[model samples]
Target: MSVSEREKSYEWQVEDARAGQRVDKFVTAQGEWSRSLVQSWIAEKRVTVNARAVKANYRLQRGDRVALRVPPPEHLAVTPEEIPLDIVYEDADIVVVNKPRGMVVHPAPGHHTGTLVHALLAHCGNLSTINGVYRPGIVHRIDKDTSGLLVAAKNDSAHASLASQLSAHTVERSYTAIVHGDMGHERGTVDAPIGRNPNQRQEMAVVRKNGKRAVTHFVVREKFKGYTLVDCRLETGRTHQIRVHMAFIGHPLVGDPKYGPKKNRFSIQGQALHARTLGFTHPRTGEEMTFEAPLPQDMVDILNRLRRESGL
Candidate 1:
């Protein structure tokens, strides 16, 4: 590897004394570094061994020499622009934003600016660069067309604390969704493994061996003519976990262009899913904090129309 890839990096072998321990703990013990630093490296996806990125909880085997390459710190520029944002809540540590539909959380290829991060940089000064240059303060993200509450960390300390909460599954993330067909059960849970689709690189699939555990609990809030409004809580956050699981269970999200049918029984632009609520322990104050975003007009209108037709 190049020198730049080695400066903010290190390598160590798993001695017999440290075998069978968690990778993060093993790395910390071997390097004399703080556990928090090791955890950050894990979260940043910087630590690898034998050309594979392993999770922090991965058990280390004896004689396993892990190579870590920490990239250079991203220096983000704060350029102000007139990007409109719906600020939900703001504190010294974090910002809760009610992101509108069709807003990308961060920049990707072909989408450099006009993102929530760029807008945040324009509105707020500097943000935590924990996730890297592309996403400064983004702790979590919603889909481009999915609207609702999202939290942005303002400093590294807050980012670390929030990351820990998310890692421990302490943060509460709930979504409101409209799915086709009334579920057979009033409430149900989907415990399935999710991993990258082997055949389709762009999608996620349910796999037993190479997949990560994902759990989604969903309850039917209201039923329409042939659809259902459900509340979903994420026990584990994975890419498209909700959509994939819901689709897997034969209740694909309505208006979902990717997973659901092309034409919904109703007319809508995108999937009728909203991040209705998010709660977490405040990093600084050690107090429970929660934020809620009511359904967007499109969703509200869809539900209202459904209710009107159903007369419920």
Candidate 2:
């Protein structure tokens, strides 16, 4: 089949560690695609090794390049919902939205509706198809419980530009979080590798083997008797990077159900993390732009309660 305009394309350079893995397995491990879906793509000649069509069981070489194209799902449909969006900025090329806590970024098995994508689809009507139908113009994502600012592209060129900037580590993303313990130091950096937890398949952890490089620079903003407010800037965006790193250092974020203590005192719905500031070069204008969102009311209330208890 001819490549569709809505098909998403991806390319990866096989590293030494993944030299002997089957192409289908490798591709499935990289992203949201399942092994069965990858095999279907391989069978359809949508997957290539070094620009040559490859089989599902092809063993990858260390220096080989693997490319895959995924067409929009014909069986699955993403319906546009009239959910309201907290748009911060908008132009012909892009739109910046401050996604509220408890909103999923894209459509998945259980989150088919009531997602940021659904709201964006209803609001924008026309979004870049670089990420296929489920993700539409989504360039990056923050956790569902972590309310923050994220930008969506209106066209392919803008999507490519923003994605390239993220890969180059030039886009600025800063977060504010409330962690469990008072930090010992005023400032520090967590330069560790992050990958899926071997013990818990559903969770992420700091792993030494086969893990991608992840770094987070953090500074103490305020301290309470049992908790610390911190400003964390990500040098690399890894899934659950901040939560994993903070927990690894004995300071898991407050209300973090996945990484924190089983019994928590806080009554918050989820982790007390928020994407506070986002900066990037305008894809169409080549101008630097930055946007900030104030802490959500729930977080503000928690902080106020802490301050009151400490007589601050």
Candidate 3:
């Protein structure tokens, strides 16, 4: 990575500010950076009011020019280690990958190395830079323990189109999961809205307000003695929506540490969720495309073992 790419700057002018407004809030509203980022810059003395360093709580007057510098996130140089990748499909516009379990989708916090992003960087140089330094070509994300099909955009135009499709709920995504209990019904829909849990910030929950609309449709595929295999489709994407909704209905996914029962029915470290299919239209060509990935051997073995144990 070049040193030049590690820093970015922009100028802003505070206008018509009411008295008693803090400098950080005034500058943040006038600039592209978020308020939290602005506060950090003020503390670091990277934000200057009329070429003078000021505290975040400094009062703002009219026509104050604020200069701010935001450093690029600390990123580990991506090395193309020869990690095996299951390339389901690839084209000029996009690439489909069968991401395996235990692989983080992109670099973050403790997982700065050995991520899919690093591998993609090595495999395809100069991927779409729309997602910034951490995620070069990523369009969507699957949790680290959740294995399944994922798409990557190779260029900016492709990224823009795919992102639009996702936002508009045009992209089709499907998953297969093993949940804790048998769903008596053949099929059902969960239309509960989801948001961050008020009590537990780390988890998501069904909330009435301060939540986004989320709908999940599920069909019972196979029923074991105490568990059910379900095919799930998403109508809206919210963080941890499927996991939270299923658990709310008393059928947490097997092996799901966060949402499942205290005693996990399966031996896997993460949730028993697999992104089985993905479909989208090519941004440039406008042709529809779809891809499917069979369940990983671990999930298959676990199901088979449960069946045999139940004498089914």
**C-alpha lDDT values of all predictions:** 0.85, 0.90, 0.84
lDDT of 2 by residue, 1-312 (tens): 445537889999999999999998888777644355578789999999999998888999999999988776553268889999999999999999999989999998788789999999899988886576688889899999899899999887898788778878999999999998879999999999999999999999999997999999999999998999999999999999999999999999988989988886766888999999999999989999999999999899899999998899
| Number of clashing residue pairs, candidate 3 | 0
Better of 2 and 3 by lDDT: 2
- Model 3, residue 119: what's the lDDT? 83
Strongest candidate by lDDT: 2
lDDT of 1 by residue, 116-233 (tens): 9998887778788767777788888898889999999888788878877887899999999999887899999999999998888888878897899999999999988889999999
Candidate 3 collision pairs: none
Relative to the true structure, candidate 2 has a C-alpha RMSD (angstroms) of: 5.4
Q: Write the candidate numbers in order of decreasing TM-score.
A: 1, 2, 3
Query: Where in model 1 is the C-alpha error above 4 Å?
Result: 1-18, 22-69, 77-80, 265-267
The TM-score leader among the candidates is 1
**TM-score of model 1 relative to the true fold?**
0.84
What TM-score does each of the candidates earn?
Answer: 0.84, 0.82, 0.77
Name the runs in model 2 displaced over 4 angstroms. 1-45, 49-76
Displacement of the residue 6 alpha carbon in candidate 3, Å? 13
